[model samples]
Target: MKLGNIEEDSKMSPAFFLQRLPAQRRSALHDVINIRHAYHKLCEICEEVSEFYGFTIFTDMAHNGILVTLVSYFLLVFFIGMIKVDLISCISYGVIIVWFAFQTTVLTSYVTRTIIQIEKTANVINKLIRQCAMNKKVEKELLNFRCELAFQKVKFTAWGVFSLDRSFLASSVYGSVHQRNLIYVKYIFFKILGLAPWKLNLVTKPSKNRTAKTIICKFSYLGLLYNVLLTTSVFLMTSYFCHQHNSVQAQVDSLVTPSTMMNLQYFAVILSSSVFLNYTCRQKDMIGILNEIIKIDKKLQKYAFNSAKNGNIIINLIFLGHLIICSTLICLQYFFLQSFWLAVLRCWPAFLYCWLIVQYTIMLDMMEKRFKFINLNIVKLGEIKVNSEGLEPVSATRISFLRESVLYDVVNIKDNYNKLCDICNDISDFYGLPFLKVMMYHGTSTILILYFMLVAYYESKEFHLLLFIKDVGFVLWMVFQIIILTTFVNKTIDKIAGTTATYLIILIQFRASTPN
Candidate 1:
């Protein structure tokens, strides 16, 4: 969702956009107030619809995925039967269970996608509000616009929920809905349709809330617990063979599931889920962002009453929430890895799901760009004078105005504006981050993870032929991982990056100091 420099430059150019406005003389207090109010109302409607779409869509899929996954597991259990709990039966059960899990994942992803729409709508509304606040003329006329926008937002959001519920119920025909024994065709015909083809792929009509939270909750808990148990088996196996066997058979068992390998897989799952969960939220998060943007815009109505402390505090709260959520999910990931690391990783479908989670997290972080809302301060009473074109030059005119401005530099305030624009533009152009450069930053960790897998493989394996080749391969992999790790480490938590860089920088300095 990030943009490039030119786009940012365009947005920052107040004069350019203001030129598109009606003639200055015609731009009286009353003339454009209605138009602004209309736009604001439209934005509110979009916001409500988006919110409804987000919450309902997520809950629908989550509840349904839980149901389908449980049914899938039960079907696998039925297929395997109690009489045969042997290796062949176990593998069969796992395969079927994985199939069911994937089916549920598809619907979950769909609902998750709505978050993006929500985020978009929210951003738009917020931008509109910011504009209204910044305009002194509009502010006087559009004082009542906020109340209307709020009302419309609530109304549309309610409708969105109803629509989402219907959408999910109908579209969930691809899997077992209720019991494993009830065939898909029966449910499709009797429960969903009664021969009504229109309501086939959506959900049950009349929207009686057949979401079945109980079934979903029970199944999710069981599925998660089962996976955990599967991971714990590694530890159990480790203990079992630690002193039980001494021969090659014992070595074979230990070799079958290494703890470190399991740890790596677990780490991967955490990394992946962090991305996926965040991405799911990101899909429809724009709606909320827009809403928040409007609130910020309203706050800017009192731009002269600004405080750096409040600004920073608001920003910190957002980052803090993201950290807390990510941390909590990572813990869940560790448990899953500890219990069923091999089995889950071995399941290619599950692996993709895990990977998707990480991708989403990275994207979610990237989508959060609040720095653009920096308030413009009017310092001296006469500093905010109209230009020949009647547009704001983005700075105070008088040197004495510096004391009252956000930058506290009334002199050449245009320069400060230009500086912020330059940074925004460079980031947009160089990093393609009109907003946050999340994907680019996250790429570091993903690359490091992949390199480590290859490194671990080559380092542990033995081949007598051309022994030097193995050492070269190991070194190559290590270097690759280190490079990617360095970039990500530099951006996310720079102190760690600084500590590492000090050594490298000093080495570079030493090499230069030695004068070759």
Candidate 2:
């Protein structure tokens, strides 16, 4: 029956009626009242699980599980649909597809049912309210209960990116599939270079030996040896080339000037050596920084809806494209001066240097995102919604909520900001010397390349298209890297300043509105 009709007919609320009933019935009502407390406990358990599993850094287990199953299902379907495989292969694919489908169905059905069951409590509460007349206190209690249910919903999310519900199957499948190739490509590249920070586990269980082994295995000491060898080889090759072109006339006659090539060679050597030092000598500090980042992300989860979108795929793709184009140009330049093998070996230093720069840029981008998120939260604290009337100040209730919830959030934000600043400091300390070398090299190289390009254009009888293109490309590429790095640095600083200003504004407003 409708709630209005039941209210008209009822003499007393079901809760009041229960008070008059036997102790046995009252005891049962006590159990019903304890559901909220039970739910709170469940939430705590889930959070603990999330922390243990490092779900904050990556997708939750459920999302990964579902995504894997769906991908496998699609792959099998495609193989079977194409009808290119033999009978046995087709049969195997069919069996696997069926199993995957079953798993997906069971998972989705169970989660959907759990959600429906939780929602059914509201209906139960409404039934109780309608069964008998509710006194103001009982009515208020029921209203509060409903409000709690409305505000505090239990949702299963994949790193807070998307909810895991019926509709999630399609979106998750599509999204994972779309980004899979680029993600794998970048993963492989970083993995090969041994510069992937994420290779180290952020969340460690209480096993020191196991953690140590993982660190060693993932970031092997061999990387240091490899870098040393590469740096030595580049230095030797550059020296050999310089020795062969001892005369200024010979160097000038060459397609790629010895000085320009030497600048790039030294630049590569510095970057390679820095990467080696970062992974070997400062491995512990690097790991500590990553752990701090994870901690910051976990805390920021309360204030932010999703992880920072640093556009890893897009950024990596751009870097990869640049690598291809630059490598091709460098290879062409080298072909004229040295043997094929030596030329390829010479390209290694440049490649490694570019990789290091890309990784560095990505780190800065992530930090900038965190700063922006913090600034956004601070701005939110100062915001007041307005209506058709001139201005509507935040309600006392809203202000109280902010004091209870966001006041602590403000403190945490401040702590996170400080931690980020420290992380940036640590980063600068680690990369400062290498970055200085890079700046010096780039500045000198730019000037030399421009002057040479002008001389080559004006003094030479014929316009060398290849040399002109290479010079222009190198200058533009260096400028682009500088611009990107500076942009992120400036944006991060702006965000930090904005956060401080907003925080101060809110504090002043709070103090001004308070009485002695």
Candidate 3:
């Protein structure tokens, strides 16, 4: 195809060139070009409207509403499927499922079609540039149009977080299911450890009434009893072993040795476990603290705190590392002692002690995140420029509204900070004794391990490489745990201090901005 005159073609509509083309080609090109133009115009209108109001005004609410509605329907269908329901009910559920599936399919199909149509428009533009006799001007315009089409392609999003397309449905479902499963896994892990003494009520919304019901489970008492009995057994066995070892050593007139250090370490572990058992007795308080923390997490989800994801992974990895180290030490004990039951009895307290420390450290890390999030908000408030110069004069009412909003935000942040402080106090009260015991155990163990290592290196006649390596490893592990625990605690303290400093800075700025 050939355009007779470039100037004339430019003067007429771009679609005028289609008149010279074949009937079939002309109709298709005309339709594609018209659709592209219409889509472009529609996108511009949507953009302007979105900018005038707000892009994400109802985004979260819409997404949550849809998710809840679909999930509720699916759950209803599932419950009906499980029961011996009447024929009408079964048919109704089947129809509901089918209707939802059909609706989802239709929505995705239409979105896919629109995307395909946009793609086709670009392809048609390319074909016209190559197949038709076009000047540099026409080719440049076509290329520019193609670039615009590519740049401004239509795609729906959920609060600008993720695209809504065929994959969205699958990903949304997968994410929801995975999250539910992960919560259960965490609950099971904590339940096994006696850290979570209460029952997990996944179906019911978390509230005071539900909390009471969940805490009423027999498993909580059983877990607590099991921990108490285990602590007692471990302590008694450790005491018996220490007594027998000391008696033998006294008869031989031996000085402090590796075996002696081991006895001391076992005692330290027993002491830590005993302290932890004391905390485990306050299951109701623990549950309440956890529920409050959950509420804090939910409240802060709108802020930068949401970016601090993969917390579960960190917790799980810490637990896994603890498990590996303890298992290795236990295996070594089994190999050397040649008594499975005795090795387990001797090593169990140490494992429990480390596990308790890990739990305490995890809680500290969570608190630190919340404090950090609050500090970030405070810093952001401090950074807000109070004086807006070389701008349109804002109305008195608008300025008053802005001032009220800022004050409201500050009040809300202050309230959250106060609540966080209360939560921290509760955590401290809950873990205070256990933390002290852990610190004592770590300090004594470290000094003894180091002293023994030094003595073994210089004064000992025979040095067992494996035993020496194990001693070094144990000392390093204890030091590492102590460092991690202290680091989280310090970070939380620092964030709290920073929050105060931020408030003072903002106050100074406000004073400086005010007229005398």
Best candidate according to TM-score: 3
lDDT of the candidates, in the order given: 0.37, 0.61, 0.64
Score residue 409 of candidate 1 by CA lDDT. Answer: 36
Once fitted onto the true fold, the runs of candidate 3 whose alpha carbons sit more than 4 angstroms away are 1-187, 203-219, 233-253, 257-273, 302-317, 382-393, 511-516
Give the TM-scores of the predictions, in the order they appear: 0.27, 0.55, 0.58
Of 2 and 3, the candidate ahead on lDDT is: 3
The ten-residue window of minimal lDDT in model 3 covers 210-219
Report the lDDT tens digits of candidate 2 across residue range 1-516.
233343444435677545544443343344445665786676566555434544553453455467657656665455334335567765765676677567656766765676677678777767766674445544556666677777656655546656555645544223433344444566567756655533443234555454311112234455556545654666677567545644522225355666656565566555665665565566566667766787787688676434423344445556767666665655665645445555555555545555666767767877877888887777675552112111556667775665676567767877999999999998878767656766766776687678777766678656767667777887887788777777877877787778778778877866665557
Worst 10 residues of 2 by lDDT: 211-220
Model 2 misplaced regions, further than 4 Å: 1-188, 194-198, 202-220, 232-275, 308-321, 334-340, 383-402, 512-516
- Cα error, residue 396 of model 3, in Å, equals 3.6
| Evaluation by lDDT, superior candidate among 1 and 2 | 2
Which wins on TM-score, candidate 2 or candidate 3?
Answer: 3
lDDT tens string, model 1, 244-316? 4323121122333455444543454444334333323332232233233334433443443222222223223
lDDT of 3 by residue, 35-59 (tens): 5588689777755544443346346
